[model samples]
Target: MPEAKREAWITGVGIVSTLGEGADAHWQKLSAAQPGADTTTFAPFVVHPLAPLNFDAQIPKKGDQRQMENWQRIGTYAAGLALDSAGVKGKPELLSQMDMIVAAGGGERDLNVDATILNGYTQAANPAAFLNERLMGDLRPTLFLAQLSNLLAGNISIVHGVTGSSRTFMGEEAAGVDAVRIALSRITAGQSDIALVGGAHNGERPEMLMLYEFAGQCLKDKFAPIWERGDKGGFALGSLGAFLVIEARDHAEKRGAKPLARLSAVVADRASRKPGTITETLGKLWDKIKDKVKGGQTAILSGATGSTQATAEERAFLEQHGELAVRATATYLGHGMEPQFAMNVALATVALAHGSLYPPSDQTGLEKPMSGSLDQVVVTGVGHWRGEGMALVERVG
Candidate 1:
């Protein structure tokens, strides 16, 4: 006979965003429908900046903090939070065996260097050689090393001592989906007993804004709630980090770890993103997890990036399942790209543990309120351009 699949539970979550740090602070701010976006700083393009964090609290060594870029520091700090939440911090035995999966974007660009090169290149006698000289002379060697996507995972392992196998995925929002999907798959398939999975995005950067602006994906001018963005849809970049400690139920039980929520299923799909592709892809994903959902007791935590077609199609899909309560978190947190889906899953676990969904903040009438007790949360990720995914997070009882 074949061995039965092991159950997977989300035992710990570490999250830091514009709303604040940790589960309690987020729950409190979200419960009050308070948003933490900054409209003036990156004006014209709205952004949700990271809340003030003291790196010393999680990363003790000043040298370690200085070595990493802001996003890496954010992710490493969140990973430490997850380890602490899982009661594994300082437990070298557990840390040594814990596997890690991280979803990350290319590291932050050195804008000053970029600007200097751009400004001087056209004026030089030999533009190519001038550019080459600036690239070779002005940029520090350590800057290139710090920009590697895997460095976030490396820093986490170094500072937190999580020395197990490490994997990093990069594909914008899709990376976050796959990171959690793979981690859950490993645990349920009995290949992994315990794992830390998540991602971080530092969207408060000039290069990021410029790149997305080229695609016309940055929410500009006035900041509005996600659903209200209409045809002028664009994502308001967010700076945030999220990490979760997920383990096989038996493994968690043996360690006396308390589960915050059970992660029953995670499904992902890539659509060509033609006119109606998102809706079609999401319908197929919803069908796969619908059987595990109890109509009235279930709700949705959407990772809608507020991009024009993507948000609209995801909204259409949710409208078909109107019986379920829905909240598009990007309205509050903005969109953290690589970390968006992981952050939503963390929020879903938090909502399940609290037994209540935060009140609706959208004036668009799309985010209706829920009355009864909350038991299940279907977290949805319809990537701004390419990926669609869903995961069912339910109360552990």
Candidate 2:
């Protein structure tokens, strides 16, 4: 089959994040500015652009950290919601024929099995060393099991009776999109009629925070020290799990499914990880999308993480498209890491399906345009000019 001939439509979705679990809560949190992202925290002296963390937006009680690793909690919760959205919940027979693809990075760093093993070895060698190694401590084997990314697929498969092929990928921020490409390719090749595609990452870890800080990528605020030092649009740290059910359009319709939007096209490329080529890569994506998007799309759900380089390039792309409106959901979803783009794709599906824009996080007095606006960084719920609300924009390769 040809690339253009391959078609996929989203029939369902699920999300699990600091905004709380379930699709309804996810929609509510993103559709409006929730009062949680701004809470203050005194845990560590990390330089946050919106630091002094005023909102108490940590994981909710239902998350049950004692039973699952952060990644597993996010992955499973999101997957369940996606299956529910597709109306395939609790039906193992329907999912048994589908393929599964899960994405994530820094998988289970906090659940360090290496340290545990080292302690175990020392304890076996010397009984007294057990005390020093804390080998007798209550070690939760379940914690280690929860750390594997595949367990995410396993949980969903067991619930849905998905006995077909399964796969997982890792590459930090790029894993989410890669998972989509893989799933789409498999369907195009007739490997399966449906797929559960998504990416998962945890922000509650010190590594994600450390990496963000080292990169100097916090969202800018009036009080952030990084802002005073000339850093702008500082990024926020938050967790996200986003998944979509991708199936052929005809198949979806035959099953009485309402598609959010047609997966008309998806393309990605990589250059050296530097500031200069990010725009070029996105431009390449635009090129591939130009013909498909030109007359059909009125809104662009950007993966802009509010970092200096990404935001600048995205702004440049919008600037060239004079009159094409843009809507960035990350402003509301918090700083998305791996599978971040998947979350944005989900938000786009929501807008395309419902014709409603999810509002952006208010950055004090900053009056930005909803990325939906032509050549501007427009925020959502401002003066959004709702167009046809279809994903018709084509890539101009």
Candidate 3:
């Protein structure tokens, strides 16, 4: 006889975003319908800056905090929060064995170095040599190493002692979806007993804004609810850190850890995004998990970055399943790139644990108020440009 598959539970969640830190703070902010966006900081371009965090609380070592860039510090801090939430913070045994998966983008660029290179290269007689010289001299030796996406996982291991197997995924929104999917898959298959998974993004950089602006994807000037962006759609880059501690049901039970919610299913897909492709891909993903949803007790936490075409397509997909109460988190939290999906999943776990969904922020009437007991949440991630994914998070009895 074949051995039965194990179940995966969301045992811990650590989130820090524009709204605030931890599950309680976020829940309170959402419940009150207050957005934490900053339209003036990076003006003409709107951004949701991270709430002020005292890094010493989680990182402890000032040296560790100093060496890491802002994004690394955010991710490591969030990972520590997850460990604390899971009751494994100082447990050497658990820390030694807890596997880790992170979704990350390339590290922040040095604006000064970039500006110098651009300004000098255009004026220098030997532009090629000037560029090469600047590349060799102007860039810090450690900048190259710091830019590696896996460094976030490495920093978590160093600071939090989560030294188990580590894997890093690097494709923006899809990376966040895959990180959770793989972590849950490993636990459910009994290959792993516990894992820490999530990602972080610092979207307040000039270079990052410019990079996205090149593609015409940055939300500018006025900040509007994601659904209201309509034809003038773009994403307000957000700075956030999100991490979750997921464990096998038996493992959590053995450790006396209570689950916030059960991760029942996660499905990810990529469509060409040619007109109706996203809607079609989302339809297929929905079909796989739709049966797991119970009407009246279910809601959706949508990871819809206000990027033009993708947001519209996601809205269309949500319209197809109008019965489910929907909330586009990007409207409040802003878009945190690689961490968007994980952040939304964490929010879903929060909602299921609380047994209620937050009131809608949309004035367009697309998002309606949900009442009564909330037992399940279908977290949707329609990537700004590429991937589409969904997860079913259910209340644990």
Candidate 4:
């Protein structure tokens, strides 16, 4: 006989966004349809800047906070919040056994060093030699050490004391998809009893905006909701941190941990993104758990990054399921790349716990009033470039 699958439950969620910190703060703001973005700060490019946060509350060590970049500090702080939410913070016994999965992107670059090299190359007697000399001597060794993607996991381990098996995945939005997918899968397969999963993005950086702008994916000259961005839709990058604590249901019960919600299943795929590929892949992903999605109680919490092809293709897929109420969270949180999917899943859990979806904040016909009790949530993730994924989160009680 085959072994039955163990249930996965979301015991805790920690997210810090432009709206604020924790689930309660976000609920209060989003519930009132007050989603704000800073258009003037980044100017031509819109961004949802992170709210004020005290690193001391989480990292506690000045040396630890000083060595890390803003993005890492954001992630480490969020991880501490998740540990606290799970009732495991400072408990070495529970933390020592907890696993961790982080979705990460490359660390920030040294723009000052880059600028010096760029200016010197034009005026140097030997441009090539000047470039090599500056590259070797100008950039600090510690800067490169801070750039590795796995350091987020390392810092989380050091700060929060989650010392069990650790893994970090990269590849933008797809990383977020697989991070949660694998965490839920492991819990369900009885391989891991508890795991921390999520990522962070620092969208306030000039280089990021420049990079996305080059790809023609940055929203410019005015901010609009994701759905209403029209023909040339683009994503407004968001500066935020998101993390979740997922564990086996039986294990949570044994530890006297209350499950905020059940992670029923997670499915992911890399869509070729040509023509109708995103729509087709999303359809297939939805099939993996469509049976568990209850009609009136279910709604879609979309991580639609508002990039042209991706947003349009995801919309095409959503049109097929027009009956399902959909809220593209990028309309509010903006798009935080590797962490967007996890953030939406966290939002879904918060909404489910509240028994109602937050009020609509956009003029787009796509986002409508829920008009029903909430229980099941279908969180959709469509990477700006390649991935397509869906996860089903259901209310525990």
Highest lDDT, which number?
A: 1
Better of 1 and 3 by lDDT: 1
Model 3, C-alpha of 4: deviation from truth (Å)? 8.2
Query: lDDT by residue for model 4 over 202-236, one digit each (tens)?
Result: 99999999998999999988888888898887999
Q: Kindly state the number of residue pairs that clash in model 2.
A: 52
Give the local distance difference test score of model 3.
Answer: 0.91
Best model per TM-score = 1
List lDDT for all candidates, in order: 0.92, 0.57, 0.91, 0.90
What TM-score against the true fold does each predicted structure earn?
0.98, 0.74, 0.97, 0.97
Mind giving the per-residue lDDT tens digits that candidate 2 earns over 41-114? 51442221221211112223443434556566666667767887898766666687777888776456643644
Tens-place lDDT per residue, model 1, 1-397, is: 1222999999999999998899998999999986657888888899999999998999999999999999999999999898899999999999999999999998998888888999999799999999889989988898988889999999999999999999999999999999999998999888999999998999899889989999999999888889889998799999999999999999999989999999988899999999999999999998888877898999999999999999999999999988988998988888999989999999999999899999998888888999989999999998888898899999988
Candidate 3 on 170-189: residue-level lDDT in tens? 99999999999999888888
Q: Write the number of the candidate with greater lDDT, choosing between 1 and 2.
A: 1
RMSD of 4: 1.6
Q: Who is ahead in lDDT, 2 or 3?
A: 3
Can you give the lDDT of residue 303 in candidate 1? 95
Backbone clashes for every candidate come to 0, 52, 0, 0
lDDT of 2 at 143: 57
RMSD list, candidates in order: 1.6, 7.8, 1.8, 1.6
